[model samples]
Target: MECIVRPAQSADCDHLMGMIREIAEYHNLLDEVKINSQVLSADGFGGDPFYQCLVAELAPEQEGKQGQGIGKKLMSEVAKLALARGCVEMKFTVAEWNVRALAWYRQLGAQDKTEAGGWHCVELGGEALQRLAGDRR
Candidate 1:
């Protein structure tokens, strides 16, 4: 099956949302998903977009193909976009428990910043975010 990778259009929001929910569910974080297709469309296609997304659609002619180079192709396209935007690096997070993904990324030449650079990913959100914003002293 041939995978056609391209920039995601606004019309693809529903399909994208489905994929997002599937990933979140796979990570056992489905409850953490707070956005819907409406929010996705607004945040991704509205003025001053926060991020860009790519979609890889497989040709439907082939039925039972798996473990192909689709992931690598998607990542390659992402790298091209990052380079075009003059980005110094491309970074993403994956659960440490996902050994398969970790191994795959390592094979793809991705460095483990958490291990080598002693970096910690942090989050400040929900009520904590509101509290911090309201603190003006």
Candidate 2:
């Protein structure tokens, strides 16, 4: 399968969301998903785009193959995207127990801050996020 990693367009909302759900399901966190395609398209393609995305998929003739370096290609493209966006560093959080994903990341020369530098991953979302934003006034 010749996998092509490419920048995602607004038309890819459904497929991209499906891939997101797939990953969420893989991590046993499907119930945590709340965003829909409209939000995805807006956040990804709105007046003020929040982020960029890349998609990796098997070629049309090879739709069902896994572990075919597609993900790595996608990540590689993401690295390029980050660089093009003038980012100096790239980072993503992985669950502590997701050893497979951790290994894959390591293979890409990504350092695990938790294991290597004793850093902690933190988040402030939901009501906390709103409260913090509201405190600005």
On TM-score, the candidate that comes out on top is 1
lDDT of 1 by residue, 52-104 (tens): 89988877776424468888889999988889989988788989999888888
lDDT of 2 by residue, 71-133 (tens): 777777888878998998889899989898898989999999988888999899999999998
- Candidate 2 lDDT (Cα, 0 to 1): 0.86
Query: Best candidate per lDDT, number?
Result: 1
- What TM value does model 2 have? 0.88
Off by over 4 Å in 1: 63-66
Residue 136 of model 1 has an lDDT of 100
Question: lDDT of each model, Cα atoms only?
Answer: 0.88, 0.86
The lowest-lDDT stretch of 10 consecutive residues in candidate 2 is: 57-66
Report how far off residue 112 is in candidate 2 (Å): 0.9
| lDDT over C-alpha atoms for residue 24 of model 2 | 96
Clashing pairs in 2: none
| Each prediction's TM-score versus the true structure | 0.92, 0.88
TM-score of 1: 0.92
